[model samples]
Structure formats: C-alpha cells, structure tokens
Target: MAVDVEAPGLTPVHRELSRAYVEWLTPQDRQPFRPHVTLMNKATVEEAKAALAELGAGWSAFDSHSPALLLWRYLGGPWESVRRFPFTGRAG
Candidate 1:
C-alpha cells in the first residue's frame, strides 16, 4: 500500500519531527517518509480502486479532524525494530 501526506503549510514542530524521523533511520532504510495517516491497507489493485471509490462517494460526509501521532514496528530477519511516529495526518 502507498500513503501520502497533504499538509501544505506545516508547522515547524511537524517539520522538525519529520526530519528527526529520517535522521533516526539508517540511510539504507530511508524513504521519502512524509507525514500521513493511513486509514486502511488494500492488498490488490482492485481492492485499492474499490476503496478509493468508496472514499470518493462518502468524502464530503465526514468533518475534518486534527491529526495524531502513530507508531509502527517492522519485524524481519536481520532487521527488527520499532518505528515511532510513523504518521501524523491523512491526505485529503
């Protein structure tokens, strides 16, 4: 699954937090870690498309809400650690 953040005018605190996350990760483990809130994960292209369609149908029904911090962990061979502050907010 792919995620994205749509914060146009980020506060300094948010920016600093993002920077800190990148700095904390090793170079090989770094990607463009943008601040975002992931609502769901779809396994297939069809599933993703269906989810997008549903989101579009009900997009305007929900009120805006402030973002929050989320932490995640990745477990695998030769690499097992926790990733704190994985997301801050969702893209519109």
Candidate 2:
C-alpha cells in the first residue's frame, strides 16, 4: 500500500522533515528515498495498481500522520550498503 501524502491532516512539518532528510543524503543514497509507506512488497505492477485502486476507492481520505522510524538488518551485508544517515527524528 502507498501512504497518501494528500491525507487530510498532514502537517507541514512532515513535508519539511522528509525534505531535510532527503537533502542530507548523498546522491547515491537519495535514489531509494521516496515519501511513501509500503504496506506490501514484491507485487507485480498490475497487481500493485489493482491494490492501489481498491485502497483508494475504499478510503476516500486518510488520517494525517508520520511513520515512526523502523530499523531492519540489511540483507546485503553492511548497513552502509543501504547508505547511512544521521537519524533526525523524535525517536532518533
């Protein structure tokens, strides 16, 4: 599932923090950064579109919120492989 930024209660701080975090990343690291929350993984494009359409139709709008920071082990060796950044959020 995709996190809708257009969700009714989104705050400007959310946008700013995302922007700042992206800006702080190196060019290569920046490539994977997109303002989204993934609810499922490894779906084909067609399946993804169908799921998204269903979600949109069901939820006319979404509640505004920021995702909490989550840490996971990188499957591909070191954390640096995924690009490192100084944490910059309340939980950090």
Candidate 3:
C-alpha cells in the first residue's frame, strides 16, 4: 500500500532515513520519494482492482511505529529478508 511520507507518525523518520541514504539511491529513487509497501506482485488487472477496492473500503490513517528497518531482496517469486536495523529513537 502507498504511504504519505509527509504525513504524521513514522514519516519523519522515513524522510530522514531517505535523506541519510540519498547517496546510494538513483535519481528516480532520490527525488520525489514516494514511499509505499508492495503487498502483492504479478496479480492481474482485475484482481488488483478488486483487491484495491476491498482494501481501500476500510482504509484509514492510524498511528504506527517503525521498530526496525527491514531490507529485502526479491528472489524470483519470493522475497528474502536481508537484514533488520532496529530503531533506537522514538517516533509517533
């Protein structure tokens, strides 16, 4: 699902983290950073639309905490967790 980096909560940490790693990111990834989490892959258009509709119907903003940063590598169909960097500071 898509996330507003400018929104309240864990976004400030995300924005700061992105800036900290800007040198490693490509131009497209650096500028205009639009944070989002991929929930599904390789789904058909109809299936995606249906899923979006179903999910969005109950979507709402809520407070959350980013206890750790997870690094993942896509291995064909499944993804592999590379590492986890735990957050040592507080965030809303």
TM-scores for the candidates = 0.44, 0.41, 0.57
| Candidate 1 residue-wise lDDT, 3-44, digit = tens | 455655555545565577766777644655465556665457
- lDDT per residue, candidate 2, 1-92, as tens digits? 56734533334545555587775655755463345667667888999889888876876654654454343455566553443444355442
Which lDDT values do the candidates have, in the order given? 0.57, 0.57, 0.71
Off by over 4 Å in 2: 6-28, 64-68, 77-92
Candidate 1, which segments miss by more than 4 Å at Cα? 1-11, 14-23, 27-29, 61-72, 76-92
Evaluated with lDDT, which candidate comes out highest?
A: 3
Candidate 1 Cα RMSD (Å): 7.2
Best by TM-score: 3
Give the CA lDDT, 0 to 100, for residue 2 in model 2. 66
Question: Comparing 2 and 3 by TM-score, which wins?
Answer: 3
Error of 1 at 53 (Å): 1.6
